[model samples]
Target: MKRIYTIALLLASLTRVVAQEAEQTVSSKINQVAVFLQGAQITRHASVPLKAGVSILTLTGIAPAVQQQSIQVDGPASVKILSVSFRINYMEEHKKPEKIKLLDAERKRLTTLITQEKSIQEVYLEEENILKTNKSIGGTEKGVEVAELKAAMDYFRQRLLDIKQQLMQSERTIRSYQEELAKVDAQLTELRAIKGQPSGEIVVKVSTKAATTAELDVNYLVNEARWFPSYDIRAKNVKAPVGITYKANVSQQSGEDWENVTLTISSANPSEQGVRPIIKPWIVGYNNALSRRTVSGSMMTVTAGNEVHGKVMDDEGQPIPGVNVVVKGTSVGTVTDVNGNYSVPLTSDAEAVVFSFIGYNAIEKRLDKGSEINVQLAPDVTALNEVVTVGYATSGDDDSDDKSRIYGSSAQKMKREITATEVIRQTNVEFKLDEPFSIKSDGAVRATDMVEYELPAIYEYYCVPKLEEDAFLTAKIMDWDQYNFLEGEASLFFEGKYIGKSILDTRNTADTLVVSLGRDSNVLVKREKKKEYSSRQFVGSNQKVALAYEISIRNKKGLPISIVVEDQIPISNDKEITVDKLEDSHGEYDHNTGTLTWKKEIASGKTELITLKYAVRYPKGNRMLLE
Candidate 1:
């Protein structure tokens, strides 16, 4: 019985050793990545030598924020994949970035220098104290010769001066080292601000018939990575083709660097919910005791206790100013400054916070236990269209205050190795680059020029003198559908100078795409109230006011230009108030919106004028201002 028990224990111990040997750790290389508008899909490949039995392959260096459900593993058909699982490799820490490492080295060097200099200064201080304690040269009770006293005085004076000079020089050196150390610390702080987690591991259990080299492919979706579209539109004059340069701004902080890997920029986001929304029954009913609808317009005051502060950035890793950060379910809010930083006081009622911008998607984060919450907002593909209005918009002190669009290019341009080969898929478009790209895990935007086009376009000047004095140049392109252009911010350049930025508004279903080329200084426009045609009279029980305006446009350029002018008449909403149009200068009038539009062509050095007259009548006692 004892011999049998010993044999059983030995067998159990051997089985455990075999089980441990079956598990193998493998390192995978990221070969390619498909970055979408909101997320990214990483593809990694590895070659593993499988034994002729059950083997567990643990792949390392996976992104920590990977979606388990999106993970896919492909290998030889002979090897059957038994099971797959993912877990954070808490034991294995991420390697510090090279920049951070260099900065740390610099910091250490400066710190050591400062310490040595301070120690020298301390020694000098001690020596000075000793000198002061024995300052009385020779014994005071004995009278010394004048020559000896002079010699001692000279020695003491020169030595003390030398010590003071040495101490001052040492103090200066230490201050300089401290300044350098502070700079290194600032750089380290900026680099370390992007918090990255430990690498993730994927364990795959497989059964193979024989020992062989298996080429495995693994793909999964990861968060904190995205790409956005932007453009640069240039036109020399009205007769030249509109030059358009399409670009993609890619950014990632997925804790995994894509080193020399093929990139595919896609317009589809795999992170979005795939389920289609269904329409529920539309039941209409009157307001009852339990069915009363309540609307909230007033903001609740924030109680002071805790403060939430963070920075807001776009998907391209650029600071977004004027973003509204508010407490969820309350009106306590604050706007981000020019640096995209905000601080809002919070109370116990504040369970969550929301960050919203005009052209970016809103982000909501729960305040579970932290005070600092930084967020990166993706551009709302649908919200770009909201800036494309029919008439001119007024500029405000803040760019986000009005619907005014912005256009600007990157401060520096980088030359890329290759262009993209566009592939049209059923659900999304993909731009596959020809060469591999090395993108770091740091969240910095890397702009890649995708494609350029010189398309034929008709140039026209647009003006709304009542709203703005500037005449905006616009390019109208027909059959713009062939471009497959997405709505994005565009930089405008005309006559060899960069004018401004505008939205590449493609939300219109029409075949013609109108691109704003920004304001033209050569085309002068002015609107003035014609006092001779304006009058105000008070009749019995009612007041009548007649208003007239004249708009003038001058072509200062040497070439003739066709321009469109638009103005609006007030639309009365009150039943007692009535508005009548007297004259429109043969312009097309839309009664529904009280808008008048005129198309005209002016020769070089010529001016054109258009007149609009309207009248408003309201109750005599109630005052109404008309212009």
Candidate 2:
């Protein structure tokens, strides 16, 4: 019976030993990531040893914003991937098990020093009390010799001063320790908060028929990561091709530090809403009976918080970038990027949001729904005038403002559904970086290069003498649409020197794309009104003014350059006023815009002159201002 019991116990212990072991594997650090325009794809590798059975693997420390549905796994054919699962490690939410030992040690050291110094202070006070209790009196006190008393008195004074100095030094040291402690506490708080990146874990289930080592490839989607395109157009000379240094500004707040990883930036963002907007029926009516259905224009003040997300667009539904989005009566504001998309986070007291951009009229919209609130700002006539001057725009402060489209024509209104699979074909731009990159979780503008194209360009000199005497050098690039470009700030360089800046306008309707390469100091131009030939006369209650102007351009450089010198003739606004009898020497005039353009060539050290004469007639009873 005893031998049978012993055998049963041994068998039971052996059975328990078999159940104690489990199959679990740890994944390696992320080695590659594909970042899109708004999101990123993170990949991690893992090798698991299977023993002809099922096994489980967990990849820790992934981004919290990772989409579980996008997670994918790949491995050897023999290794069967059973299931892939994502979960947040809630254990970390309540407490962080790890700590910086060095910081904690230093804190303890400083605390000990403060406590010792305070204890020493109490001893000094006790010693001072003892000295006071020992002060001698006339009766029942041993009166020492005068020299001895004087010596004792001097010793007491010096000791007190020394003690006071020690206390002050200790207090100063305490303050210094406190400051350092505050900084240490801030770091500790940051560590405790676990901010700057969202951290989580990934788990994968696998099974195998035979024992083998399988390499597991895992990929997941994470948000708060993006890359945008920018360019640097540099031209060495008029004959050379414009050097376009295509750059990508990659920014991410995703939790993991992508250290020495393979990075690929795609023009794809699956987060973008691909749902086509449904247009409601528009009923246009001026009937008086419809007025009764109108709501009040006056809005009651909003005393609570409201957050809104929206796109700033034109009336034609084109995105308007760099619009200032501000909550009314608050200093908190932000400007839209090149995409013209803005997300406004409001305070509790925010009433409404105001959108303002150059060339567009200011708009104030009240937040009603939490969803997207698209606002279309109409083009202001005065603002349009400031941007479009002499057929060239330079005063537009908005980065998205099109130079050639100051008075933009309406675009076709069509709702189109765009999806992730079709995004690459739609965008037609994938910025292939030169090499591998490792970006920290910190939000920063990191640049990478794309391929450079040397397309053919024609250089021309342009001068608007009435506005400025300087002749700007422009390079007209053909087939500009071949390169997918977003309207952005361009730094222009010419002739081996950094000249200035120019805006790259892709929306301009022309056979060739024009880029201003800045001014040429060698080409001198001037416009002057001939005062001797200009006069004003009163004839039959009408005032007639005659004006003459001359413009000259000299080519001081060695190259013979063709210049387009531009000047304009004013037109009257009133029916009684007449502007006629014009004398143009060059005969290059646009009657519609009253603009005179001279496309002529001036040889080296040679000069060319253009003259214009016109008359303006207005009624004498009223005053008129003319340009």
Candidate 3:
């Protein structure tokens, strides 16, 4: 009985040892990354040397915020994946990135140097104190001569001066080190903010038929990574082709660095639910307090739209927190959250909502019922200088030929080599880069060039003198749908100079994609009121007001140009007020909006004058003002 009991204990101990050997931990490296609009898919590769039968493999170094449902593991045909799970390993610490390691070393060096300098300064201070304390030339019992006293005084003054100089020099050195340390600390704070709190581990249970080396491919979705599309539209002159450079700005804090990985920018938003929305019945009923539209009276119309909610992003597609979104001409307002998302109920008097953020240009978007208004605020150069954050870049770098510096350059003087293949998928498009790309775990954005297109476009100048005196050059591209452009912010350049920023709004249903290339100073426009036509006359109980304006355009661009001039006349909805067009207005009139458009081609050094005349007749007894 004793021998049998001992045998059972020995077998149990052997079983425990075997189980521990089968459970092994392996390190994986991220080899591929696909960044979407809202998230990213990370692919890692690991080599597992497995013995015959079942084995539990734990893959380390994954993003902490990975989506478990999206995790997938692929291995060699000989290895069968039975189960996979994820967990956080709080006890383990992943290796820091090379940049972070360097920063840590620098911090240590600076701190040591600062301590040494302070110690030297302390010694000097002590020496100075000793000299001041023992200032007498001789002891109290002994009386000194005048020559001896002069010599002692001279030595004391010179030594103290030397010590004071040494202290000042030491203080300066310490100050310099402190300043550098402050900068280093700031950088370290930013990096630590994006650093992973705990390491992530993926456990996989697999069965192997024979002893072999298996190559395991693991992929999962990470929520901390995203990318945004951007564009650069350039035109040499009115006659040149519109050069468009498509780019992707990618940012990631996924804990693991994507070093030398195959990068692909996808237009997919995996974070958004893929379910289709259901259409509800559009039932109109009597006005109630909860109704979106409510009429106060016949004269004073009160109409409201559905709640307006959308993101407010910058030109680089980064969300701007603390943005003020207020309905124009009203006190109703709301601020954007950290994600740059805001929702404000539209009031009856809401014509447009103004979005204002410091250091960015204010955007006023007209309200539309049940519409998402995603606005991209351009940086106000006058208020603040734009700062671009990247993984690494040297200040005052003289390497003009560096291809990496060419993307975000204000002028973009050099054309980068575009090496991305466009892949059209069923749901979205992708630009797969041919060369490997590396992005650190830090959240600094990296811009990659996708493709460059020199498309044929019609260039024309448009001016609305009453609203703006400058003429804006626009490029109209037909069949723009073939290019598969996502809505994004575009930087405009003309005549080899950067003009301003504009949005490539792809939501318009118009067949022609019109891109405004900023205002042109070469085309001068002016709108002046005509004195003779601006008169008031009394006819019986009614009064007639004649309003006229002259819009003039001069082509001082040294070349003949085609331009469109626009002016407007007020339209009254009341029956008592009557409006009539005077003779020879000579413009295409839109009766619904009271808008008049005139198209013309003016020669160089020539001026074209367009006259608009309109008359309004209203009852004199009922006071009305018309100008």
Candidate 4:
């Protein structure tokens, strides 16, 4: 609803002869842009010349994605806005910037100068070549005196040198002109691309009692804008607090430039059709042949896909939660649950699936006629290296069997000029940008700096040589909720060195947030199998295997450190399989999961060794995954 204020003006009695009708086109400047997770609203200010009665003023250069009802027109009390309307002009041509004419003129001048420079250089080169080609000067001119022959030779040589110098100078000028022309060509190309897009207009009819200049603020909602949080977590050392560089990936394709406007990014989507959806009645009836044509609006339908289930693990074989698993060449994917397990449907044409996480290297694995794939992602050192790009991709209907060609993305990252402050809205969060920014009509993702924090934490070393050879360092932060972090990606830097990428999953987190700091080489860890005590034997109709392993850890650091050593034993699911006498030396054993954990504080320069032993008995002819 458009709100109009009816305030009386004391200076003038409202006298109307024939009502003065006028039409004025006003150009509005985008003063503020409120970007959300789903949509954006642009607030523009344009001052218009007003008569006493009614004037229909059109606000030009609007986006076609505007929701008509979301338009809000505000002005002073004396100016009563009568009606608001929107119209999309598809056939209307875009007006190129007047500066483009000046640019084109400069480009043409530079190009002409380059051509003239090249022509002069060519003539100089031709004359120099002709003079150099004549080597019969002495033989053809034998009648000439010796001093005159020497003078002729010197004169020819000087002319050739002079021509060469002229050519060199022309070549330099040509190169300069060519460089300037290239820049102008790029500018013209950009402008031309923008000149072909569609535009809309908003018309506002205002009735004022007297002639005055009226300031109008118009706001409208638009789609194709979003913002997500990204982080760069840096730890100078175990003793220093972690420094977090909070940033935002803001993106938009609002069909116009935002200009030097104050930008606000929000996690809330006001454009979303609110909750409390009406439940439609479910009718269950069998149709004879209609089942074959089940697609509602499509003429054809084909559903062919295979489900891929997998677990994502870290270097230590620890389940990594919140890892993204997507099919290659498709946006269809899902994230790993708290148990580090994901199940995504692979289209029949999909050859592989890519597993990605914040600090882990993304790996694409081929299906190879297998439904279960367990992957171990190595840590990528460039994980939190500072990304200035933003966008979102999500899985659509698996029943969509249309084998459309996957096109390459021409999308560019949107860049914001200033940082923002987070505001707590009624339903979601909003980040108000501190400085102004401008984004093009093309859908590009840009980044903006958000906030920074110094987090306090404790660091520890953890090792599980049974699964991985390396020892990993981890940081545990208390009261992580204070950061108000949403689920997103983060880059980790340990000891001022980039370790890898990791996820900031607050979904299933406990009171403390445990972040992996990547593998550590300074700590000493080793795992050894004792061949003397390990053997396989067949007793009666049963086969028996005995295994013994030793793990050693040393504290080589200057300060005492706490370490957690982990090992595991196999569990049997078959009735005939039996396991007995599993012993963990100086560690606690979990019966259900067959896990062993040893927590110890080792003094500087101290070494500790732990032993683990187990026996397995099964049928003679059977083989298990253990071997």
Cα lDDT of all candidates, in order?
0.76, 0.66, 0.75, 0.70
User: CA lDDT of 536 in candidate 2?
Assistant: 90
RMSD of 3: 12.5
Global CA lDDT computed for model 4: 0.70
lDDT score at residue 54, model 1, on the 0-100 scale: 83
Tens digits of per-residue lDDT, candidate 1, 1-627, equal 999999999999889658845779998999999998667889999999887878899998777767777788999898888888888877776777778878888998998999899999899889888888886756869988899989988988888898999999998998899778766754553345333456788999888878899999998887667766778898877767777887887877677899999999987766555566698655556854455556644444333335788999878776666565766644345556656788775644566888865335789987764789999998666521121112111211112221112111111222222488888877777889888898887655688988777776666788888879999887776566777676655778988998766656555346767787878789999999999999989888898999999999999999888888999998999999999999999999998999999988899999999999999999988866565
- Which stretches of model 3 miss by more than 4 angstroms? 1-21, 96-186, 282-417, 621-627
lDDT of 4 by residue, 416-529 (tens): 223677777556666777777877653444667787777665667788888776777776666677566665556789767788776555544678676667887767899999
- Candidate 1 weakest lDDT stretch, 10 residues: 384-393
Over the stretch 360-446, how does candidate 2's per-residue lDDT look in tens digits? 578988755444678888875651111111111111112123333221112221212211111234443454444567886544447
**Which stretches of candidate 2 lie above 4 Å from their native place?**
1-25, 50-56, 74-85, 90-198, 205-214, 277-280, 287-427, 571-574
Q: Estimate the Cα RMSD of every predicted model relative to the unseen true structure.
A: 11.8, 15.4, 12.5, 15.5
In the range 402-452, model 3's lDDT, one tens digit per residue, is: 333122234322334387888988778889999999988766667888898
Name the lDDT of candidate 3. 0.75
In model 4, how large is the Cα lDDT of residue 567? 88
- Backbone clashes in candidate 1 total 1
Model 1 RMSD vs true structure: 11.8
lDDT of 1: 0.76
